[model samples]
Target chain A: MEEEVVSEENVTPVDEAEGADQEVEVTEEDARLAEIAELNNRLLRVQADYDNFRRRSREEKEAAAKYRSQNVIEALLPVIDNFERALLVKPEAEEAKSLLQGMEMVYRQFQDTLKSEGVEVIETVGQPFDPHLHQAVMQVEEEGFESNQIVEELQKGYKLKDRVLRPSMVKVNA
Target chain B: MEEEVVSEENVTPVDEAEGADQEVEVTEEDARLAEIAELNNRLLRVQADYDNFRRRSREEKEAAAKYRSQNVIEALLPVIDNFERALLVKPEAEEAKSLLQGMEMVYRQFQDTLKSEGVEVIETVGQPFDPHLHQAVMQVEEEGFESNQIVEELQKGYKLKDRVLRPSMVKVNA
Candidate 1:
């Protein structure tokens, strides 16, 4: 009987110690699992963010290439306008005729270069005035034109591809 | 005595079951810990990659803006050369003089626009020949010029900012 009691005491203490150790281990394991879940969520979010950034950067680069010539073309518009005005002068003198011929050749070459770069003059007279492509400088009543039709183009407007570099200055028929 | 033996049998089975459960729990906990570590490493790497990408993208955007006018300017170089040639012709008649004046004004305006965009002509005559900025087409023994010096510029070279658009065609003294 005494041996049995001694054996019982030994087993009971060991069982209690094991129970406490298990409680601590289970809490620690639960914390580690929670950490793993949190880390996984963060990783997914970062990956998605990176993917979005890459796509946006690619789109921006394409747009930059498409519109690369915008500023230079815009700056040259006034120069082209002056060239057109100079070409309109009538040359009566023989010397003036030769100089005018040279000017006309250069002007044609310039136009060809602009055309190759996707530049086009916007049509204005008799067409419907579009606020996106035309700027009305005057409103006039003309017998041969319909309402809201452009009666005359005062200044030429240019577009590069679909982007309007300058709006056409036009007289609108009321 | 029989009851004590029965109680001991019950306790022994419970302890064995608890021991098996603890073993499984420990293994599961270890797996969770390893997963957390791996996920953290991935997150760190992804974040670093994103930082590097953002920096590279910013630099690319700046470079694109700086060189945006490069292609248009290159295309216009031949046209400018023709304009310069036309301006060199002297007008004898009154009408030719006025036409030349208009052409000169337009040419000046064009030059101003180019200058504003950081375009500059490379110096050639009397300057030491530089392979980076000058292309020697003819070597000549010219008087009053040092050896390896540029005697004349056959065709003008241009640069936009620090980048060479074209090297000057030059005659260098042997």
Candidate 2:
């Protein structure tokens, strides 16, 4: 009887071990699938981030192009003031007159440089008024002029390439 | 004898299944480890990309600041030419004389605008020669001047803030 009892305990444990082994097999397969899913999710996130990075780079380049000349122009504003001041001088002698002539040469050189760089004056007079290029401060009914036509420009506007740097201030025919 | 043979076949298949299950378990564990490693690698690559993006943005901003007024300054060159042309006129009448005065006024206005924008003329005469700011075109011996002192400025040089827009051309005292 004791020998039978000892044998029975040994067999029972063997059966339990087999059941546990099978359970481990199933769990192992599930774990592998979960790992694959997690990896795929990470790959997707990285790809998305790469796409955003490319878009931002393109935008930065465009912005850089649009405003590339802002500082240089700002610096030249004082030079413009100097030109105006030179023009205001009333020459009393021949030497002063010659100096004025030299100033004119410098002024022409400055203007030619600006033209070569794609700066254009906005034309407002005798054209149909559009809000994008012109700011209308006054309106009047004028004979032989179409309604909404710009009658005169109070201040000149300028454009660089296709972009308006300053809007024209104008009088429109009502 | 037939019953013993049939029982042996059944036992053989059970042993084979256990061996196959163990093999599958080992391979699954290895695959799990590989997946984790791949995910970690991807995470690292994304982080590196982000770092690069930030660096590029900083570079772009610096470039923009450096060249912001390039276009505007280029455009204004034409206006300078016009000023020069006006100065060349030897006005024979009062009307022409007043126009010259007007031109002088404009020139002064232009210079003041440039001064307000951080544009400065490089001083060369009697100053010690520095290669970064002055381009030496000639060397001459002059009384009461130190060696390497700038004797004259052949052409004006300008700086916008800390950056030199143009280097001064100079004659240095040998």
Candidate 3:
């Protein structure tokens, strides 16, 4: 467009070649119309490109934020298990009584916070085994349920949004 | 183009009558070439549109995955803080000792996992204050450092890739 653009020098050079010529001046209307059309086309393309770029950037940011926790959350799962185990213990001694109470509060808060944050626990026990969410480690023939039903979850599944962050290790009834 | 596209049959009867008198025999070659050209043009546009659509879908998926953790990680920050505090505790008693050790191991692994996943701790101390990474709450005139330099970080900043998740709160040297 820069090379093709009409300049004052280009017009003068061409006009001078036809010496002593009667030149009809281009009208303001024609120039205005040409300019308007060019502007209109450019504006539309610009708007479209901006829209696409906005959409792309937004998606990239979201994807980055989502999976960033994949590694850390999985690493913390063991800690969560330990917390659960400690909380499960009955406070028999005088020293453990206060310690147990504090731990319980921390564990409860952690669970509540994870729940609110879209860290959903995939329910596997007593439900049909799904390959998407469950990994069959051991199969058992159980009564009152379908053959592929989930008998018990050995390790719980976790999800970040619709994507499975971690699949549950389960005992299937198959 | 068929009847639905060209509507050639709807042409005036007079035009057809005029054409019937013409001795010029239009060969099938010209018609086939024209059709091929038209199809090629359509194919090009379709391919371009398909590329655009594919790019859009890919970007959307990436963005969805990225942002899925935004709320989740923010919610888990409190739990992380609790772990950090628990690590700082010196174990003087035997009660809950094993649990503490296990939690410590889990916490270390969690930190390592976050590092691997592009979740970075924004460097805050002993550097020139950058408005992008550091938020200055109070200014202090330090002997060794120049003006607008960070003296201390109040809270660590966090980032994922090039994007800043949280700005570090800092005390700046006057």
Model 2 lDDT tens row, B1-174 = 000001121233347776575456445555565666777787788878878877987887787676566445434534544554556666766755776667666656665666665567789998999999999999999988999999998866677777777788999999
DockQ of each: 0.40, 0.24, 0.10
The sequence of per-residue lDDT tens digits that candidate 3 reaches over residues B49-168 is 656866886776677565544555666656666767655655545665655565566666656666665667889778889999889999998888888889888877787667787888
Judge candidate 2 against the unseen true structure and give its global Cα lDDT, from 0 to 1: 0.67
- Residue B145 CA displacement from its true place in model 2, Å: 1.2
- Candidate 1 interface RMSD to the true structure: 11.0
Q: Kindly report the docking quality category of candidate 2.
A: acceptable
Best-performing candidate as measured by lDDT: 1
Q: Which interface RMSD values do the candidates have, in the order shown?
A: 11.0, 12.6, 14.5
Query: Which should have the higher lDDT, number 2 or number 3?
Result: 2
Task: Please state the error at residue A149 of candidate 2 in Å.
Answer: 0.9
- Per-residue alpha-carbon lDDT of model 1 for B93-144, expressed as tens digits? 8899999999999999988899888899999999999999999999999999
Candidate 3 local lDDT, residue B56: 83
B2 Cα displacement, candidate 3 (Å): 24
